[model samples]
Target: MSRLITLVTAMIATITTPALSQTCPPPLNGAVRLVLVTAPDMESTGGLLQLFARETPAHAWTPASTPHPVRLGKHGLAWGIAFEAYKRGDEREKTEGDKCTPAGFFRIGPSFGFVASERHNYITIKPGETVCVEDPASPLYNTITQRVQLAPETKADNMADTSLFRNGLFVDYPSDRANKRGSCIFIHIWKTPDTPTSGCVALPEPQVKALQQFAEGGAVLAVIPQTARDRFPTCLPDMSAPHDP
Candidate 1:
């Protein structure tokens, strides 16, 4: 009787240990939806981006849409200070005007566009009417503000003059409200496959349109570096699980 009990216990442990070890990491907790952006390396400006959705946190991510080719920052990627870093005191590897795309998990914020009646979720913009605050000395640094809100002499980038800002979604980096980690990170329209952005991710216009239709508020965009791809399962285990029949 004692031998039989030991055998049964060993079998149970074998069955359950692997499953529990494969649980999703903290970054993905409570995220029922996500967008994964992957590059070949920290220096590669081109890569594939895909959107995924799940019915619940415990379930696997299903392909919500097709993968889109995208462009990253001109200088490549660097680690940005986000929620996880804020708690742990990780050093920020990127700075303002570094021209490097930030690699981390960021919440998706409001969309902005030039057309008032555009078929997407975005704030309307008139030429020279919108600006994103990049001045660290100002209280609104790293935020998007209307031109009317600023003094005439205040330094800010004109979002309208650039065709890229005609339609775009905000990426909420620097999750800490009080500190300025980086500014004006966005997913916007790309000029061409060969052209890299200042620090934002760029997609072709048609894919940008598709993204506008697919993305929802409160979703997270996770930028994972290629060198770390092997460890991705430890961070997002649902993606590794076998599909349900």
Candidate 2:
């Protein structure tokens, strides 16, 4: 009996060990709220964006808002660093300065903007003080911190640009300084419908303001390109289908 038990234990471990190293997209984990962003193709500079919600963790996602237009990275989308997509062929992995929006699952905000948002833990950007670090060499790389925390020469995006970031939401994207797998991503106000971002998603002011509701609760952001859409079809809405009016 002891030997039989030992054999079964070893068999279970052997069966599950290799699964640990496999790089698949993260599970939805019954997220009640989601923000879906999908591009038509890998090179698309703009795509459809929408909000999905459910009554409970066990409920299916329903479109909370109409699919709206939004701007993507000038270089379009790439598989995120955490995503080692199998059989990817020539599809690029996100890297620093790629100008491509990192496409994969990400946690949404701790909502931010220029003014104090009454929603929840709103981050009020202070001009010349608050910044998002972009210098890969610095310890503060890919992190949000005050300008005073770094040496005068460090490269960071000043979050106080009211023209662009008057209303913004921080995207909790995983940072990889050693590999330089992109950094400083966010969802914010756009300069125009035609303009693209360095790597963040952008929308007009009104569209972005609608996202603040998730600041109190939590939300997941799914940025997937059309090439990989079927990979996780069960959790995503069909962008190709005509949405209800």
Candidate 3:
């Protein structure tokens, strides 16, 4: 009888333990929904200066892997982030180049992508869509754009400039250092499930999975330079006001 009771207790423990351990709890307690950027210096991380929403203290909730030096947009004027989340190819070392990414803030967004695993998602952009790249007259020039092909290498031809656009993040060229710098920057997914990017930051599969859960239109990401964090204001009202034409 005692052996029978022990066996039953063992079975119950096994069943209950597995279920209890597998469940993921909500985000860390009181972890404000703000985007946090980290630099190689470690302490330099946490440049959470931008305000994402008006109602909540959080400006945005970005993955822990989002890159630094967030950029802000100029004209279209919405909060945005520029990250090294996606790379052009499988080579991880490609991200080492200095010119691979833009430095300052730019208007970003209008989330795009098909659903992946409900916990992993990404925005898709082609190679020649003509996103803004700081060009003066190119309509959508100086803004985010997508191109139709992958840039084999970075050069005067493949660089993020005014001629091309990638279907990812928008570019905002401040007047101080303006030019037709071409575009095709993206806020897409990593090359591999566990891979990092060339010039964009990477989010865990789970965070992106939460994208669809947020309210639309009012969402925006603010990317800025490491220096800009201290200079710019923290938190802003939802700039995506309703359009009335």
lDDT of 3 by residue, 46-99 (tens): 122223323332223334332222221111121122222321233121111222
Give the candidates in order of TM-score, highest first: 2, 1, 3
For 1-245, candidate 2 gives per-residue lDDT tens digits of: 99999999999987876432133355345567788888877787888788887776545668888888888899988888666652167877889999998888888867887888677768889999999999988899988889999999999988886578888888888879999888889899988888888889998898788787654598888888777777764657555432111
Q: What is the TM-score of each candidate against the true structure?
A: 0.79, 0.84, 0.36
Clash pairs, candidate 1, are none
Question: What stretches of model 1 exceed 4 Å from their correct place?
Answer: 1-27, 83-92, 117-121, 175-180, 237-245
- Give the best candidate by TM-score: 2
Question: Which 10-residue window of candidate 2 scores lowest in summed lDDT?
Answer: 19-28
Q: Give the top-scoring candidate (lDDT).
A: 2
> Which candidate model has the greater TM-score, 1 or 2?
2
Between candidates 1 and 3, the lDDT winner: 1
lDDT of each: 0.71, 0.79, 0.31
Q: What local lDDT does model 2 show for residue 39?
A: 83
Show the lowest summed lDDT stretch of 10 residues, model 1: 236-245
TM-score for model 2? 0.84
lDDT of 1 by residue, 48-96 (tens): 7888887876566777766667888888777777433422233236677
- The whole-model C-alpha lDDT of candidate 1 against the native structure comes to 0.71
